[model samples]
Target: MHEINWLPFWLTIKLASITTFLLLLIGILLSYYLAYNRHKINTIIEALLSLPLVLPPTVLGFYLLILFNKQGLIGTLWYKIFNKQLVFHFEGLVVASVIYSLPMMVHPLTAGFRSVPKNLIEASFTLGKSRLETLIRVILPNMKASILTGIVLSFAHTVGEFGVAVMVGGNIEGETRVVSIAIYSAVESMDYKTAHIYALILFFMSFLTLLALYFLNKKWKPYDKA
Candidate 1:
């Protein structure tokens, strides 16, 4: 058996965890707005947000690379403030993963928010609860399944990232080298055994994630009906 480098696996987990957390916050806010707002521009905003779902990872990564290059706007501003490069670092990987996995988080949450009964929200408002309060106490409680699904999907998507992670973070061992990059490296070096192991790990991880999501949704199904 080929000796597996576990560092990349751990790093991938850390990246996914952080990215999913951040995405949860951002996704919830965005989904809330998209659910409640009826402006024509919301369609445009949603389309922009969902672009990553259809866009090629390499294409997105290439643009991100340019945008975060030392000479680019974000990079220049970050350097001026922190005196550090953003690209080719773990931070960049997190940013890329968040952007890449945002649709997975937002889409599900948006649907969940929309699935919430309007009269229930109205009743909460009628009782003098603020929009934020209604969101927290009413909308969210009713959509626990969607929330779990979004979180799992975001984490799994981030863990499976390859092109964006590589393009934004590069292959810096013990730093930016995640499992997807490690698998690519193993394959490039014709190390089939290592590649197989990595592939199996990711496959099982993704499968289990989805399986757990479905199971949880099933368990929560009765609550949602109530």
Candidate 2:
């Protein structure tokens, strides 16, 4: 029984959870807007949302590294306001994770929103309901499973994130060292036992999370017969 460092594991979970929560909130709104709006700007927004899917993670991470550098536009402003750098910290990891997993969170949500029948949405609005009310009471309720699916996917993907964290976070122990990066370190140093343990843990956790999500969606979609 190799004594495991549970700190990195827990910190990774915390990072992933916070990242997923923020992505869920922002992704849902972004997806909704993209699904419902046909403005020319929406196309650009959608393209940016999907960029992570096509771009290599390392490239994305490198870009983020530059973007969050001390002299970068938002980075300099943020540093002056908060007296803190967004690079080489847990907060930086969160930002990288969010960007890396944005598509995972947004695509499913966009699909879910689009899946909602237009007639039902219109019917809700016909009853003197505002667009917001229609979204809250009708469209969203119908796509609960899809939203859940997106959240689960985002959390699972963020948990297993490696390149973005490493590139942006510097893999500092107890700071930005997430489980995936820790496992890589363990492997490189010939700490096979810990590496295997972490790998197995991540594999099983992701599998179980996805299984639960699918089963929950199955339970709901029985009444939503196509």
Candidate 3:
């Protein structure tokens, strides 16, 4: 019988949940700008936003580590304010996961916002609805599928995070040892059984998430057309 350690799995859930929640709010604002803004710098901003999608996790984590180090800008500021180190903490993991999974949230949301009919937006403005009101009442309601996809993708991506998590947060057992790092440590210790269990759980979770997204999109296609 393989003994499963639930701590890492639970911790992964906690991290993914918090990351996804924060990303949802940030993603909506950023995506709205990217989708509608015609500024020349929009292209450059979009490229930077999408960098994480292509960048290696370890590479991103390395830079984040520097940024969150005691001597680093963000770290120094945080230390001065909180008198606590940002590196190797759960809060650090949350920050790392947010940065690492941002594109997953932003891309789909931008597409969704762009897909909203321009006429409907204009009509909303004509009816005295502010940009924020139109965004809340018209745009988001029409892009349910895309919003759901972004949330699911962001959550799953955060759950599967390893390189960044390990780099920034380190393997501090219950503190920062999420499922990905747990699997890595298990394998390194030749505990194939434990590693397999962790790997299988993540595999199924990711697979199901994508599956749900596809199914929901299909179901919503007719409504979206109407």
Segments of candidate 2 deviating more than 4 angstroms: 223-226
Q: Rate the local accuracy (lDDT) of all candidates.
A: 0.91, 0.88, 0.92
Query: Candidate 1's C-alpha lDDT?
Result: 0.91
Please estimate how well model 2 matches the true structure, expressed as its whole-model Cα lDDT. Answer: 0.88
> What is the TM-score (0 to 1) of candidate 1?
0.95
lDDT of 2 by residue, 63-150 (tens): 8999887987757876998899989988888888999999998998899899988998888877899988988888878888888888
Prediction-by-prediction clash tally:
0, 0, 0
Model 3: worst 10 consecutive residues (lDDT sum): 217-226
Better of 2 and 3 by TM-score: 3
User: Clashing residue pairs in candidate 1, if any?
Assistant: none
Where is model 1 more than 4 Å wrong at Cα? none
Q: Order of candidates by lDDT, top first?
A: 3, 1, 2
Per-candidate TM-score against the hidden true structure = 0.95, 0.94, 0.96
Give lDDT tens digits, candidate 3, residues 1-226: 6668899988999999999999999999999989998999999999999899899999999999999999988889989998988899988899999999999999999999988889999999999999989989988999998899999999999998889999999998888999999999999999999998889988998898889889999998765555
Off by over 4 Å in 3: none
